[model samples]
Target: MYPKLPSLMDTRIPTFLKNFNLQAFEVVGYSAINAKYQADFCHVSVKDAVMKGGGRRVHGWALWEFESHIVGNFHSIWERPDGTFVDVTPPKVGTKVIFAPDASLKITDDGTHQTLYQNRTSDPGLPYIDPLGNAANHPQWMLENSNPSLIEYCKSLGWNNASMA
Candidate 1:
């Protein structure tokens, strides 16, 4: 059993996301047309990490992109006074969140269009601070420490495949 997680509407947005410089880059070619008329917003993706010792885990959240339209399970970005980002989708008690510097952009196959944004980092093992205040192996460690309430919440949100792993 696990403690109740915060309500989805109660989590706050991070300051960096709130003040994210949308004008820092321009949409080019075909994507630009979509940007002009669509509602621009940010995307958040939930990630997991497990500890090496046992059934301890920590979940991490990443900002996927600043988009002209909502896509998938993406949620609005939130900020903290210290300029860190937070995703309220999961249980806040034992979760760890991170921002991958490398995921802050998107490029076209033909090298014609480039968009400034952030997305999930490819490396699942990215080191992050755990709830215990120690560095833990991500994704894997997070899986081990899965919270029942969060897992149930995720399932309620339609992540039927959500697992302790």
Candidate 2:
């Protein structure tokens, strides 16, 4: 059985504040432009900081586990002091939504465009996320109706029908 979405909560965010912030490399949101309707957001989790090295000097930079969430069930973004926040989800609002924590979102003059916080690549700013995922809300797949690309790619290996290696 798959999961289902609950609601959307868009916090009110003013633009003037979002002037100076770095945009996340890849922001996500619900969209059917390419496929099925869905709500997706990007987030990250952090484990205990581990130092990598011997002796008094640690060489490796702080290690981080980078991952993407296609549908996080509930998406919550932290707001900057100026009310600007890095959009965890790209503004698409495909159809429905889950938790938006913020309030009603403020649309910009340019349709399909929203101001996202951003900093240069040199700046070290990463989101420490506690993501909420719901399997029911994700895309459904069936072995009998698997993606054609995968089937074709597998066939190239010379495997016969009904046999997978």
TM-score winner among the candidates? 1
lDDT of each prediction vs. the true structure? 0.27, 0.24
* lDDT string, candidate 1, 19-43, tens digits: 3322211111112111211122221
Report the C-alpha displacement of residue 25, candidate 2, in angstroms: 26
Q: Where's the lowest-lDDT run of ten residues in candidate 1?
A: 25-34
Name model 1 segments beyond 4 Å from true. Answer: 1-100, 104-128, 135-140, 163-165
The TM-score measured for candidate 1 stands at 0.24
Indicate the TM-score of model 2: 0.19
Q: What is the per-residue lDDT of model 2 for residues 46-101, given as tens digits with 9 covering 90 to 100?
A: 00011111112111111111222122222333333354333323334333333223
